[model samples]
Target: MQRKITPYLLVLPLTLFLGIFTYFPILSSLDLSFREWDFMSSDKPFVGLENYALLLSSRDFWNSLNVTAIFALVSVPLRLCLALMISSYLVREGIVSRLLRGALFLPSVTSAVSIAVVFSWVFSTDYGLVNGILAAVGLPRVSWMQDPQLALGVLIAVNTWKQLGYDVVIYIAALQAVPRELYDAAAVDGGRRWHVFRRVTFPLVMPTTYFLLIVSVIEAFQVFTIVDVMTRGGPAGATDVLVNMLFRIGFSLFDVGTGSALAVLLFIFLIVLALVKAHVLGRRVHYEA
Candidate 1:
């Protein structure tokens, strides 16, 4: 009895915290999805599946979902590949490498809103550093965040720049943990760089890659701050992701029921995504390294 009580006590703080913050909110949101409310109303009435039906039929919700899927599919592979290549080079430990790692990770620790605000100016058509370089090379200045065709791409670039540091840092740790003996054995058999990476290094790093894939996809779907700060889901709603739409519905429009429904949908989508990724990638992950 004493041992069992002690174990429960050890986890009591975290259990209580989650109960208050996470579980309660999730249950409340699920309950709220079935009720109509303006978030300030005294008389909250049950609306059944009316909110879900409206969201499913709404063009804005579908558009936001489409944009979010595109963002995740494009950005996840680009980030993973880029981080892998960079980590391959930075795996060797040295003073310079350590300093570079810290410098790279600075963006991850920095505020997301701050990064968006700074990049907003950097990608400005006039007096922007990016356009300034293009002009120096005798090219026309281009509007990055204003055009619908280009705004999503610019947001992806900024997100990638802000997030790449974390991926690189994680990859470096994973790469370093890979057994050196395996590489030596491959070299002894005359394995080329590309071949060795394909067979050994990459296989060993698949677990990390898979983890990052799931996280990055979820992040992409839930992206809001940068979109809000820079585009406000505008330039014709080209950059409007799911979280942006949710915020607009819940906070801006004060439609709590519809917003909760949207949130529930987002949660279900992420759950399905994680299941699919686990089913596809779990078998390929080599834990022996």
Candidate 2:
């Protein structure tokens, strides 16, 4: 009995820490989502699911959800494809490959806020480098930030540029792990480049691809700094994301209950997305020894 109790005592601190630090906060947020209480006010009113209903009925919430969905759908595939292509090229043995890989990965180590600031200047209407180059080639100057449609696209492009490097590194690692013997066997079989990739390389890399897909989706939903720094949810709430909406409600409008409800809803949506992806795509992932 003492031996069993001693092992339990060893893990008790960690269990208690997780309960206090992680589970407690989550439970508290869920509880808060069902109540009406401004952080500054003394009286707390029980609202049940009223906050969730309010957000679901609000046009702004739906609009932000649409914007977030568009951003995720557009950015993730482009970023992953570019990363896979670049990583594939870099994985080939050569002096230039090493140099190029290092260069490509530099952006991943840089601060996002700094990147956003630089991109803002580059996309600036009056004196941005992009406009200057377009003008040099005899083209019209477009307002990237001020235009509602263009603002979200600009943010998407910026995010893709910043994130692609990390994805490239991930793909590169997976590519390196693929056996050279498989490529040799494909060569012996007179396999074309596409055939080799389709039959041997891609199948083995599916696990990494699935992992990146889920993580990219999750990160895309939490995108805030780029929107905050570049457009501030834009000219007409065009770039407003659910997280950004939650921020506006909680910090700007001071609607604590509504904000908590939004957070809960976002959390639920992400969980459902992750579970669906795992259920649907998990079987598709191939693990190689």
CA lDDT scores, all candidates in order? 0.93, 0.92
lDDT (tens digit, per residue) of candidate 1 on 1-289? 9987999999999999999999999999999999999978898899999999999999999999999999998888899899999889888889989998988889988999999999989999998999999999999999888899999999998899889999999999999998899999999999999999999999888889988998899888888898999999988989999999999999999999999999999999899989988998898987762
Off by over 4 Å in 2: 1-21
* Colliding residue pairs in candidate 2: none
Give each model's clash number.
0, 0
Pairs of residues clashing in candidate 1: none
Judge candidate 2 against the unseen true structure and give its global Cα lDDT, from 0 to 1.
0.92
Residue-level lDDT for 112 in candidate 1 = 94
Stretches of candidate 1 off by over 4 Å are none
| Consecutive 10-residue window with the lowest summed lDDT within model 2 | 100-109
Q: What does candidate 1 score in Cα RMSD to the true structure? A: 1.1
Q: Choose the strongest candidate by lDDT.
A: 1
Task: Report model 1's TM-score to 2 decimal places.
Answer: 0.98
